[model samples]
Target chain A: MIDVVETTLTWRRLSPRMLVIHPFQEVVRAAPALLGLLVAGSSSGGQGHLWSVAGVALMVVLGMLRWFTTTYRITPEHVQVRRGLLTRKVVTVPRDRVRTVDVTSHVLHRVLGLARVEVGTGTSERRHEGRLKLDALTAAEAARLRVELLHRSPAAPATASTVSPTASPTVSPLAPPAGSTPAAETELARMRPEWVRFGPFTMSGLVTVGVVAGFVSRLVSEGNVDLGRVGPVQETWRWFSAMSLPLEIATVVLVLVVFVSVASTLGYVLAFGNFRLTRHAEGTLHVTRGLLTTRAITIEERRLRGVEVSEPLLLRAVRGARLSAVTTGLRAAQGSQRGGSLLLPPAPRAAAVSVARLVLPSVAGASSAWEASPVTADLTAHGPAALRRRFTRAYGVHALVLAALLALWWWAGLPSWTWLTAAALLPLTALLAADRYRSLGHALTSGYLVTRWGSLARRRVALECDGVIGWNIERSFFQRRARLATLTATTAAGKQGYQVRDVDLTEALRLAAAGTPGLLDPFLVEAQHVS
Target chain B: MDTPTLRSPQHRVSRTAVWYWAARAALGWLVLLAAQVAWLVADSDGSALPVTAHVAGLVVTAVVAVAHVTVMPQWRYRVHRWEATSAAVFTQSGWFKQEWRIAPVSRIQTVDSERGPLEQIFRLANVTVTTASAAGPIKVSGLDRDTAQRLVAELTATAQATAGDAT
Candidate 1:
């Protein structure tokens, strides 16, 4: 350990233990090229392996060079990371602006008792997307850093700050948003292995399969491999082609479902095996999850604006749901499923609702006492206009598809069953439309604006009224004709905008006004008018 | 009109907005028109349609482009309106797909104005009122320069006066 005498403000290098893992990581990163070289080496006879060796050496040198060039320092008011060899790069984040602190360690790092720290300032700006990263710090050091970075208040005006040579001192005079609370951390949720039963309902498996299929197809083509020549492939094709139409269709569907379920189960375990959600007394929510590559994320609860309860159609059938935090700083586009915002992985719907309640405890008197629960309160229906629009759009889409299929049957001499199949889908579509109509509702309750919409991915977003920054009222030509509008309450948190889609024009306006009173007053024709 | 009953915003933007919009629309259409001309030249010999057919094709495209360039701006000008009070900023924009956006002055994060070459020639500017939302930044375009400048200055001051991060 070359670092002698630790100063709070001095530039710090990554743990030297990272030197053991970087070369391996570099090789993994460059696997495709190395694999190609190996294949080409055998196919075209020689020297490709030599090129591969040289490439590995170059990658290792690059990896080791990174260790030498990179150094991070915590100034009185900011956290700065300096890296790059020739074109020097420095990323500085005001300490108070720091939103999240993530400490992750892969299998190798875990073995070496080292972790990587990622400080998330949570800005979606293109120039500096993720704040800063310090790779391969000792596990204890990373844990200590995460706490020190998030829980501790930024420098007060009294401290005379020293600027690191690599950094230009741009110290902010602003006070930290939350003073550190010295309360004990409370565990909100822990992953139960039984929750893996919800794995099959998630679409993650299909995504993995699609990616693998694409890669395989590309590899087959690139290598000019004749899959048809493979004995097993030939036998499978023959058997498949010989099957009766209905039997073949059934077989394929059965195989797909089986494969998808298995993949999703694997993914679920890999991602959420040891997931735990805890609230720190110092105003941070900690989520430690992922099996092989463990991650511990620290989020300031003061930045939390709300929580979302999401139920995909399939998951809803099984009473399974997911939960996410609606908070400032994090980019909405990154998605809650894979990041710091994920409050709970797919679990029992009851579990998600409970977690939501825990995350957003309702105000005593302010919360609508009549409702059973604050987060899952009975919402105000969007009325007949929205219902009519739902049915119209639903049948309109079905009519378009049926018409197209019928045209093919009449003009192009296609099978009658093709049109019949399209017609047969009507009942399902009708069911969906009805379900969607049922879900189309919004309510202002419990100091939160809850907008529930969508059938496929039903979301009941409970955003704090205080978090809403603006209002957007959009009426399409059809919506105008129907006298309905989509009111989007835009905020800095979560998805940024949660829409109460296809509500009556007057109703949308009323809801917006109620959510953030007085803003819409001057623009309304009559503040109290509902019709 | 048998439309929904909220009152329209106070201002209809500078009448010069029509000309500015026409120029903006034309700039886009001209490139498409140029591409059509290029493609026609490239394929003319191979397709060898009757001269009348080629002439008709070109004429139809030109007619459509010109009609769009002319009618869109007029429609937009009629629809685009804006109002800014000390309390809130309201804007209505777009022609067929109209959007009505309102951001409280307290929630507003930034007030910026931009002028492009086309806007400069028309003596028009666009005033943008940004909030902390990703779907925010309500813009009132084609304002006369004087109004745009005053609006930016006034909104900036109003936003600063309000407490909290506004989100």
Candidate 2:
């Protein structure tokens, strides 16, 4: 382990065409600022052209420098990349440590027949730190490198004895020629045109609009762009001012619904347009998706620990669900279904369940029904105590708010209708509490320890028993008073720890001991029954 | 279900752990009290309105700090326990909100011992063990320095003897 070799290794440069691609990308990145500058200059009669020209020139130069300074090489034993011209940084990862290889191509790259290859090492604490990137390569070379990195063959001998100056793609007989004999692929799920109906339930349109609006508003605020002076803005304001009070509210709501639906529909089509989940003969799951930026990610089935069935409140209402694989070393991109973990998009709950069963053989069961599938199997209820606690917590907040609202109405000059409105909404809160109680469940079936919890964004994780490394039994002050505890099964898969919240203390201990037999036995003191 | 319960781990951290907790709590309270005193002194404009209020605030803080420094240490000392066997490392810690963590010997990736300035002043140490998960590491806090060292060595040796990848 203390051995260090001082031999020089070969390095290769990125495709020269990427230099052109980089400048365009940089220009797009700076478009917001450029728009702001243009607006400011237009308001002040002129002055932004010089700055814009200089900025573009600087960006072009910076983009070209990447092709000059960045170089990477894949040896038989290690994959190395050296980046930067002024302050040199060289990152080398052992060949076997390569977990996932992603080949992504945007519209420009696809047009240029160039692709970007990112090696996911998943070893370092920071996600990006563990990644080694090759800015642009021929689509063929990118595919070859993907095979070369993950195929784990040592047939290439040039890396061992010869210090080659460039990546000799012809010499790498180690990787069975990529795209030669297409491996058998088992297609699990394909995008359906009708699945677009579940788009508005995801609320991604609202999030996208919020993000874009916030960014544009920030830029507009910094500039002199009078949004009210814009033709559409002026017309909209005039139209709004021309309406009666109730009509205006109804119109605003109707317009918002239409806008959100259209935006989310567009987003959904763009994201999952050509979504395909396929299993390869080499024991890897291939996920290829996206519209403008085509992404292809490979996940090793052996690294997969389990699967998670996710259902947000609105999606659940529409009987739509999402399926994500719980795997080690795969990036979990939060709040987006654009990662290696997503197995199915927002589709029919039955489709999501069937896809989950197909993806993970551990969930093989008889029924194809959404509820009967092991992914959504019946769970043990936490009994009336847990139910009571949920109600108390729900009504507890409502009671406090009602007291405050009534106090405000009595002491201050507030209207009484506020408290009355809150009282009228009491039934909604009870429904929510009941839904939360219904969602809280845990079970052990086959080799999977299943735990499901949460209200708004309910997720049911089915983790393999062998993947559990440790257990955390915690009793908060209130939980202790309720004679309940939260048992967290710690694993290296998605989320790291999945908790069976608010369970009877003894039952929790039993669950822990049963999940991974010998792990918790030493800590448990058996209460012998006199049967 | 037999309704089994957890038995507290076999070893209390150390007798000096009480002093360590007390000293740490007292240090935090001292900083709080010092900041409040400085604020009171700086904000006063020879006015009686806020002087009395600040003084009352000082009294309340002092009362809470005294109770925390006195009762919390003893409670923590009683709560903190640890044990290590060939199979696993177990610990029970915290006062009002207690936690029991158990990590199998084979799954432990690394074992480390640390002594902060406060721990050093109290002649105490902490031994931390971790696996590949981002969940909280198992820790044995306020141990005697030599005991922490031995614990680290024992855990490291046990981990070396096992063959799992720790993931």
Candidate 3:
């Protein structure tokens, strides 16, 4: 291994493959425009080729210019990036302030043996502050930079501080060079092909299928496909009309269910394929997953506050639950739908809980000094008044809708069976309301305040009491009448606020006081007096 | 909940808030009256609409204006309360829908006070306590100038001492 540790504020360029990638991305960006050009050409008898050629040439030039202008430099103190040709811009993130360094390689990047590096500094990512993204870096260099930036061991920091030219490249900060491994390393979770069965139950599959169908139909229509015969909408409508009304609905639902299941299974396999979670001797948990866009997330143990295990209605029916890390650093990474908080994919509730226990030492189950008795059946439910309120609210809403339907029938001469159909759904709504009311509960343990809420996707979060920074109590007109308040525990970690919904006024105050002893005591007195 | 010792009754905002609210209500009423007048003028072509529509609209507007000017101010005053200790800032505000919040000193990321033209006329200001919570900021408005300044000073001092201590 070469010990060529040159430290002279040397600027680095991204992988040369970015030249290819930049143009490819430009092409992707202009695909719709190009298609429009082609359509225009078809209409105007091949005159659109000139515009298409001009557009492609312009995009290629812009891409090349952008690639040439952007460059990043790694200093001992900060990782600085400079870009923009017209207006020069510079951004830097301090080395020690960097909380997480992620290396992700999408299909294209992977194919080119390149990866995108993201450096997070544990600050709110508003306007892209406290973050840096370097695209199209060689996979090896990305890994090296990740280690170099995160390296805080005595040997590396000392050498780095001195700008020592002889700092060995052989020593890896996180991993012990190629052949050997750390003794304390333990595999916490790994993907199992069979676990894909739980994926379809998430109902996320159905949503994705719908999205894809929408996109495809739009694409086909854009391509000038004959919508009258080729469109799935007309075909489905025709088929449904041929069958009995109920039978048609059932068959359509069944088809949708089948499509969703297939899609979900495939998605689960692709996303969680080769998934691995390991705890290292350094007290950092490393997660690596994805078949097409491989991603690696590193979570420091100290930053982990707790865990949130979510059980959606379908997932709960199959006794499956997903676990997420309640941590500070990963919040910025949780962009779009794929939350970076996910600690485990949808798995058995027991397994998820066990993994959660391992991740957050004292905040998962009943095996710690803090949570002597985990919040289970004995959780303090928001009393009978809450139940009544839920029922009244649910039934009131339903009645209003029914009345609207009746008004439409009377005034607009609508069908009468609509009222009956709506009436038939009342009991189901009532049952759900009852279930939601039943699900509302809160408990204050020795060091954590556990709140359980929701019916469809019930979540029981055991937030560390010390993590709670403030309390927000809200009582609407109806709730004030019912002597109820929604108590939200505000914390810097996790979801920012966890609410104990529809709790008794006194009980909510008590919980608030218990969670942060002195902070809410003054408010509690006034509240208690009023009550 | 273990009740804290009663240091003093929760401090109410400046009494001038009533006039402030009344003035705002007057502005709203003026807007409503203008809209009604505009509707009447636009419908002067009056093919079939009755004179009763204008009479009823004017009556409802008068009633709403009266309630907003007379009733809302008193309700708001009664509900608005705020107290700042070394540990935290406790505030209870909102008239019909009561909201009580306790923002700990350590958690306060920023302490700011705002005064608009109307508030300036009343010599009153609104103190906003922002924390790193997604539920938004805790606001204590309608404070006398002196009290607002003192509150901001006290909060800023304590917040500084507890900076970076928030969990």
Candidate 4:
């Protein structure tokens, strides 16, 4: 047996782009500081030239320090980096747990024909853990390094089964050397289409959001009013012609609203240009797009934990549904507020369902067979005794708070109609409760745990049981009283915790038991009872 | 699940961490005190503050400083742990909040050792772990040279093991 020892290796030389762009980019970034210094020096007067020369000299020194300080190296054993001028830093990362080699190119770097390569190791606990960025590398060099590291590292065994087309024509990338082809076929049967592309972009909704934001900012800053705002002006003119000055104000308000909406929609379209999605050979979903600054996001297929498709009340009329997926990593720009998934805004429900089917097959079939298990069947079978009792016990205070609101409205000497309006909330509350009940379902099979829930907007989540690196059960003071518990399952996907809330005490325990076998001691009912 | 059998080197945070935390805490307190004093002076009605209010503010400041000095290091220390196995290196740390993390030998995407000024004086370095998390990556600080080297060795061994297993 060969005794192979790990050693640090020097990184290849910095890409030529680094030399070209580093100086200008640094100067631009430090423009404000330089401006502040110039203003201060000029105000001081007597030795302005001296200070200016000194400042220029300082900036040059700092820039050179930054450039010379940065260096990186990768070996079959570990990755090493040395950086910092005043206080040098050398970091080494092992090869085995490295998850991915991410190559990113900003506008400047792209122009310079260079990319920043971030090596990500598979331990996703802390924000900066297992992450190192090498400043610049040529595209070809980066790809070659990535390929070599991937081959050397063992995190992904299946990659070995995939023979590179360039490496051998006889060997199929998907087919292993021997009997693995049959297993690969079965795996393929189970592997649904993992991503959907819209035009040239995978995340068109995000672009739309950016456009909307830009439009709003422009309206606020530049005072550009659209047709809707002009409508009020026209209305006011008509009113003036008709000798109705008092009503002119109403026309102005109406015009402003119309103008804003039209302008915002136009801006949105302009922002989201040529969106598309492409599946990489490595089972990662790559979303690429941008009119000005193009972006490509690679999301691992297994990291996808859940998919949520939503249709708000206004959207239902338009036959539009938004699709979002929740994965392990940090929240993307579009999904930060709602949690998980990308929102494919305003697609037809059929299209949404088709995409859903591709991503999550088990839950995709549930809508059509919604009746096989009546919405109320689980409610009756499990009954309030097991589930509803726990639900009311957990959220019954909300009902009382609504009742108190109605009582206060009545006491305030407002019109009696106010109380009626407040009382109308009871049905809404019940409807929400029923929706929650209907959406809740769990199935464990095929090395995965599939959980489904949601009301108007439905969600189906599938997680590999083995991939679950940590599990925690939490209960508040009130939760203890209600015998309800929340179970959080954490994987390598960053800190956006996935949870099942207000589950029946017994059911939660059972699910946790099924999901985390040896991780938690078996037959630990005492621990379960505390919650 | 069967626990994989492996051997690892015992590792601890470099002594530099204590001084680092202490200095950081002191600086933070100074900044906080300065900010609070500025706020109080700005918001005060034209008249000078009463003795009671002055005393109360002093007491709060004292309490905050004490808490900062005493709590910061413990919190820092508890949030990180590292071990080097025969095959790979593993580090896991998060306070009462637990994030069970493991970096196998073969799949380590990158390994890097970093040192700031204080760490240089103490001959210490920090190691970072990166995965595909959008929030970015995770890092562990305060490792000595010997421990870092051993970790690199273990990681290489484990990576080789994985490669062997796959083949």
lDDT of 1 by residue, B5-101 (tens): 4567899899999998888888887887787677778777756566567667778878988998889989898889999999989989888788899
* Residue-by-residue lDDT tens digits, candidate 3, A1-531: 123244315778878898898778777765654564555446643544566568788888887887788888776577898888899888887666666667788888999999988775544433345468888699988877765665444554444435544554333333333114556568899877778879888777877887767655644544454456657879877877899978987997998999888888777877778988888665667778889988877666666766787889999989998887776556622563155667888888877877866676554434564236343325887889999988998899999999999999999888999988998999899898998888788888646788887889888887778677788888998998898888888766667778888998778877877777766555443424543
Colliding residue pairs in candidate 3: none
Clash-forming residue pairs, model 1: none
| Arranged by TM-score, best first | 2, 1, 3, 4
Against the true structure, whose TM-score is highest?
A: 2
- Which scores higher on TM-score, 1 or 3? 1
Displacement of residue A178 (Cα, Å) in model 2 is 5.3
TM-score for chain B considered on its own, for each of the candidates: 0.90, 0.96, 0.89, 0.64
Which candidate wins on DockQ?
2
Candidate 2 residue A409 C-alpha distance from true site, Å: 8.3
Worst 10 residues of 4 chain A by lDDT: A185-194
The top-ranked prediction according to lDDT is: 2
Full candidate order by lDDT, most accurate first: 2, 1, 3, 4
TM-score of chain A of each: 0.85, 0.85, 0.85, 0.57
Q: lDDT tens digits, residues B89-115, model 2? A: 999999988999998989888898999
How does candidate 2 score on lDDT? 0.81
- lDDT of all predictions: 0.80, 0.81, 0.74, 0.50
Runs in model 3 deviating more than 4 A are A1-8, A29-41, A44-69, A83-88, A125-128, A149-184, A229-241, A332-334, A363-378, A522-531, B1-9, B22-62, B163-167
Q: Can you tell me which runs of candidate 1 are displaced by over 4 Å?
A: A1-6, A29-41, A45-64, A122-130, A153-183, A221-224, A333-337, A367-372, A399-420, A527-531, B1-5, B45-63
* Tens-place lDDT digits, model 1, residues A1-531: 112123446988999988889899877765655555554446753564566568888989988999999998876677888899998988888777787777888899999999988776644332344457788799987886787677654443233233233222343222232224324668899999899999989868998899778765644544445578879999999999999999999999999999999999898889888999998766789999999989887878888888888889989999999988888766543733256678899999889988888878555557434354656788999888888899999999999999998998999899999989888889999899999999988888867888898999998888888888888899888898888899999888777788989988877877888888888878777434332
Q: Tell me the deviation in Å of residue A363 in model 2.
A: 8.6
